[model samples]
Target chain A: MTSSDNTERLVHVPLGERAYDILIGPGLIGRAGGEISTRIKGRKAAIVTDEHVGALYLDPLMDSLQTDGIEAVSISLPPGEKTKSFDSLTKVCDVLLEARIERNDTVIALGGGVIGDLTGFAAGIVRRGVRFVQIPTSLLSQVDSSVGGKTGINTRHGKNLVGIFNQPDLVLADTDVLNTLSEREFRAGYAEVAKYGLIDKPDFFEWLENNWKEVFSGGAARIEAIATSCQAKADVVVADERENGRRALLNLGHTFGHALEAATEYDSRRLVHGEGVSIGMVLAHQFSARLNLASPDDAARVEAHLKAVGLPTRIDEIPGELPSTEFLMDAIAQDKKVKGGKLTFILTRGIGQSFVADDVPASEVISFLEEKRKK
Target chain B: MTSSDNTERLVHVPLGERAYDILIGPGLIGRAGGEISTRIKGRKAAIVTDEHVGALYLDPLMDSLQTDGIEAVSISLPPGEKTKSFDSLTKVCDVLLEARIERNDTVIALGGGVIGDLTGFAAGIVRRGVRFVQIPTSLLSQVDSSVGGKTGINTRHGKNLVGIFNQPDLVLADTDVLNTLSEREFRAGYAEVAKYGLIDKPDFFEWLENNWKEVFSGGAARIEAIATSCQAKADVVVADERENGRRALLNLGHTFGHALEAATEYDSRRLVHGEGVSIGMVLAHQFSARLNLASPDDAARVEAHLKAVGLPTRIDEIPGELPSTEFLMDAIAQDKKVKGGKLTFILTRGIGQSFVADDVPASEVISFLEEKRKK
Candidate 1:
C-alpha cells in the first residue's frame, strides 16, 4: 500500500518475519533492483529463471541490480514444467553454493510457477535456508503458487510431492510481464485468477465475468484482478500457511487438475497446466452437483466464463488420446492430497463455497472420471 | 524430571506445535515401538538407519513394531558423513515416495548424526515434510544433532551447507544404545556433553569434572547426563529454533570443531565429530585466554580434562598431513559458520561462559592455528 504509483496495490502475507508484500503493478520488475537492494542490503543474490522469461526480462533485471550496486548471478534454465525436477533443483543449489552465496544472501525466483517453486525450494534447503524473493511473471504463479510458500519439484509419482513451505521476503507480481504471454498461456493463467473467485470470492468472479476483456487489455483492471487474487491467497496463507486446514480450500480444482495433468503425461501441448485446471474446476463443480453438493447451473456458469476466456473445460477438449478411467484413478490415488489411501478433495456446496472433503470415496471418483471422459 | 524409575528422565523441547520429548533411559529402544505407535497412531513409518547401527538394532526395532501392530519399512544406508550427499538424499526421497508415504506418516531416523541428518532432511523435503521422529542411537546424536531440527546433507562445497530446520515429533535418546559404542566414539560424544556445561552452566561443568568417570560407567548417572544435555539443547532450541541468535551459543565449540573436521577430511578415524569438538572446545578456551578474555589456567584445565578422557586436545593429535595455517584458515573460511568471508567464533570467558564473537580477525585465527599446530 506504500507506493507512489496510483495504479499499483500491495497485499501483505502476515507471517511475521517470513511475511512479505505482493506488489501488483504495471512495471514493478524494472524498478525491483532498487527495491531488492534496499531489502537485502549488500548481500549477493542468485537469480533463477527459465529460458523463455529469461530471454525477455533477465537483462533488465540484472541491469536494475547493477544500477543499485547489487551484483547478481543469473541462471537461466530450460523453460517448462519438466524443468521442475530433482536434477534442476540440484543444479540450482550447486550454483548458489559454488557462488559461495552466504547464508545472509538472497535467491530471486524470476519466472512462473516452476521457477518460483524450484528456486524457493533451493533457497529453503540450501544452507538450511537463505533469504528468497519471488518475482512471478505468469498469472498462475502471480495469483497462486508464488504467494503460498509451497515450493517443490514434481516427482514421477505426483506433482509437488517433494518440497518445502518456504515464504519469500518479497513478491513482485508485475502485470507488465504478463503482456508477453501467448494467448493460450494468458488464458491458462486466467484459469487461476478466476479460481480465486470460485474458491471464495464469487463477487470477484462476477467482476471478471463482466470486465474480463479489460483484464486482457492490460491496465488497471488487470492489476485489480491480480491484486484481488493475491489478497485472497494472502488471507488463506496467513490463516493456514502450511495447508493443514483452511488453506486446502485454495485447491478448489487441484485434485482433479493434477490427475488430469498426470494422465496427459504433463504434456503442455496436450493440456497445459491452466487448461487442465480449467477442466478440473468445471469437473469439480459438476462432480459436486453429482454428489448433490451444488446445483448443475453453478457448474455451467463456471464452464461458460472459462470458455469465454478460451480455456478448456472438458477432457475431450485436449488434443491427444486421453488415458482410461483406471489410469486417471491411479493418478488420483497418487495425489499428495490422498491421505492414507482415502480421497481428500476440495468440494463445493455452491460457487465460492469450497470446503475440504476428506471422506470422498474412490468409487465415486472413478465413476465421475468415466462419465466425464466419455465425452 | 518426574519419573517412576530413577534410571529414566524426560527432557522436553518446548517448541509449541514443534515441541517433543527426549526420553532417556535403559532399554527404551525395545519399548520404542509402543511409544511410537501411541504417539503417531497407526500411521506407517519408514525407518532410516545406517548399516552399522542396523546390524546392531534393526531386527529388534522391527520386532518391537510388530508387537504393536505398527507396520514399518526400513532403509539402511552406509554410515558416515560421506553418505550425506545429493545422491543419498534423492534415493531416500524416492523410496518414501515409492512407499506412498503420506504427509502424516512417520520417518524414524534410527542411527547417528549422519542417519538422523539424512533422514530428517529427507522428511523435511518429502511431501514438503513428513512427520519425523528421531530415535538416535549414538551419544553424539542423542545429545545434540537429533534435538535440533537442523536436517541436511553435505554438498561438494561443505558439510551441512544444505538443510532445513524441521523439528521432530519426538526424540528417543535411549542410553542403552551407547553401551555398544567404541570407546573413541563414546569419548567423542562426551565432548558435546561437556560443551553445554562450558556454554553457561559452570556448576554443571564442575559436576561433569567430578562425575565424568561414573558417566562413562553408565546407569543412572549416564541417564542424568544425557537428560541434562538434552534439556540444555531443548531450552536453546525452544528459545531460538532457527539458530538466529541465542541458539548460536550451542555452537560453542562447533565453529572450531567443524573447521578441524574439515581439516581431517571428516574422517571418523583421524577426527570424529566429538573429538573435533573436544579439541575445538580446548582451542576456543585457549584463544579466549590468548585474547585476555579468560585465564590461561582455565584453558589448561579444559585441555587437561579432555586429554584425560582420551579426546584430542590439539591439532597434533590428528593423524596424517594437515594443511598450513593458510590452508586451515581457508578451510575455516569455507565453513558454513563463515558469514560473508568474515570469521565468527564462539569464544569463552572461562569455564561455563561462552559468547558469540562476530568480528574475530582472520589474522588472529591464522596465528592461533599456527601456535596450536606447533603443539
Candidate 2:
C-alpha cells in the first residue's frame, strides 16, 4: 500500500508461530506509529535509537504514534559502536523501566545495525524479553540487520559478544532515509546485497552485475533490489531462524568482515560494515582458491564485480598490522557458528554455491591467511 | 554408567541433537569433579558461581576438573539477587576470556538459580553463546532452573530483566549437596516440584503431597522426584522450547512469584525463590477464584498443601508494605509472557488444571489482592 510518498512490501520470515514481517518501503518510518500502535496493543511504548537517527526522525516518529494516542518516548544513545556495549544496554533498560514500559509495550529500534542490535538485545534482557520493532534507517540495516532476529551489543572481548536471537514484531525499512547517505555509504550497503548472490543466489549476482549502475543511482530498480534482498534474507532466516545449519551460509563474508571491523575499530571513516564485507568476500574467495575448493579465476571475477561497484576488495585500505594469522584464526574459532569445538567457515565454491566446512583446520586457515598477507 | 560411590540415577534430558544429561542422585557433588571431567569436551573451562556456592563447592569442583587435566578457573559473585546485575556479568565475561577460555570450552554454572542464570547469560553473550553445564546445588535449581534453557541474570529494575534461553550441555544435580542447605532452603526448592502439578502433571503433584514428609526427610524418592521433574521439564521444553505456548503454563506461579521476589530484595534470607513461588501459587489460586475461573476452596487447599510441606503461603510474611497493587500489577505487566501489552497469568481452574488469562485487568488483580490481605 502507498502512504503519501511511501510504499510497503512485507517479507514474511517463517518461524512457525513466531514468524515476523519485514515491512519494506519509504515512509515506513512514519507509518511505524500506526503499524506498531495497532499491532503492539499497548498504551505505552519506548523508542530506542542512536542520537543521530533520533534527532532526525524521533520527533516525527513519536508524534505520529502520539497522534494515534499511544504514549511514546525516545531514549537516544550517542551514535557509534560504543553504544552497543553492556553498559549502554543496561542504561537503555533503566530508562525503559523508569518510564514504566510494560512487557507488552513495544521497543522501537531506529537507526542502523548498532541501534537494532542494542535495542533488540535490551528488549531480550528486560524481564527475560520484551516485544520490539525494527525501524532501519541505514542501507546496511534495511536489507540485512532489519530482517534477522539476531540482536546483541559488543563486549570488550569482541563484537556481538552479548546478544540473543530475539525477533522484532515488525521491521519498517524506509528507503527515503537513503537520501541522507553518502555515495560511499551507499556502496558500503551493497556488500550484503552481493552476499546473497555469493552464498545462495548466483542468478541474483548476475542481475546485480547487470543493474549495479542503476541501483547505485537510486533508480526504481533500487527499491525492488533492496526489498528482494530482504526477502532472500527472510526466507533463509525462516528456515533456520536460530542459525543452526542453512543460516551459517549467510556469514559468507562476515567472518573476515568482522575481523576487519575489529582491527579497524568499527568506524565508518575507516571501515564501514559494507566495505569490510567486500574485503571479506574477496578473502573468502581467495581462501577457497588456496584450499582448492574453488579456482583463482572465481576469486578474480568476484573481485572485478565488487571493484566495478566501487566496493573495497583489498585489505590494505587501512594501515594496521593485519592481525596475525593466529589472531584472525583464533577469533574465527570463537565465532558463534562453532559447535562442539568444530569451527565452521561459510566458503563459496562459486557464486551462489556456498558450503559450511567445519573440517577447515585452524592451521590451514592460518596458512591461507599468511599466503594472502605475503602477497 | 557407574561412578565411584554412586547413590543416584542420572537421567539425561534427551533433546537428540540438543541433548544434555541431568545427573540425579546423592553425593553427586563430591563426584561432580569426575562427572564434569567425563562430560565436558574441552580442557579450558570456566566455573561461574556465586560466592556462597563457590565457597562451598568451588574447591572440590575445580580439583576434580584439574585431576582430569582440565584447566579450570572461576569468577564468583556476592551471594544474592543483586549480584545478577549487568556489571557482574561483564566482570564474569572479562575474567573468563582472560583465562583464555575458548569457544570450544565449556562453562560450569555452580549454584542456585542466580548462578545458573548469571553464568548462562554470560555464556550466551561470551562469543555468542558457549557450552554450559548446570551444576544445580539447590533443590530449586536442580528441578527447575537447571533443566530449562532459560538463562539470565537480573537488572536493578527487575528480576531476570537481562537474560537468554540458552540451554546447558549437561545438568548435574547432586542431591547430596542439599545436605548443606538450611531447612528453609531445602523447603524453598519444593515450590517448583509443586508447580509441575499446577501446570499439567497433577499426578506428580499428588505424589508429592502424598510423600511431602518422605521427600523432605530426604527419602530415596528424592532422587526419583528430581529426575522425574527434569523429565517433565524436558518434555515441555522439547515441544515448545522458547515458551511460545503450552510451555508458558509452566510459569503457573511465576507471575506473582516474580513480583514476590522483587518485593523481597531478591534476598534468600528474606524470601527465597521457592518461598516466593509457594506464596505466588496461593495468590494465583486466589486470582483464579476472583475471576470465577476456579473455586475459592481450591485456593485454600493449595495453600494448605504448601503449609503442610513447610512452604510459605502468605504475603504477610514478606515484611514490606505488601507491595502496592500498582507495583505488583506493573511487575506482572512487565512479565515475559506478556503480548501486545496484555499480561498473561497462568491461573488454575481446579486442583490440577491451569490456563492462561490475558484479559485480566490490573484493577481486578489489585482488588483480589486487597481482599486476600483483609482475609
How many clashes in each structure?
2, 3
Q: Which candidate is the best by lDDT?
A: 1
Q: Give the alpha-carbon lDDT of every model.
A: 0.86, 0.80
Expressed as tens digits, the lDDT of each residue in A59-164 for candidate 1 is 9988887787777898999998889998999999999988878777889999999999999999989988888999999888899889889999987766788999
Enumerate the candidates' DockQ scores in order.
Answer: 0.85, 0.47
* Tens-digit per-residue lDDT, B117-199, candidate 1: 99999998898888898899989998889887888888888888888988999888888889899888889899999999999
The candidate scoring highest on TM-score is: 1
| Predicted candidate 2 versus true structure: per-residue lDDT over A175-208, tens digit per residue | 8888888888888988899888888888888888
Q: Residue A73 of candidate 2: its Cα lDDT?
A: 78
Chain B TM, per prediction? 0.96, 0.92
Look at candidate 2 and give me any clashing residue pairs: A104-B341, A125-B161, A127-B161
CAPRI grade, predicted model 1 = high
lDDT of model 2 at position A269 = 77
The local lDDT score (0 to 100) that residue B4 gets in candidate 2 is 35
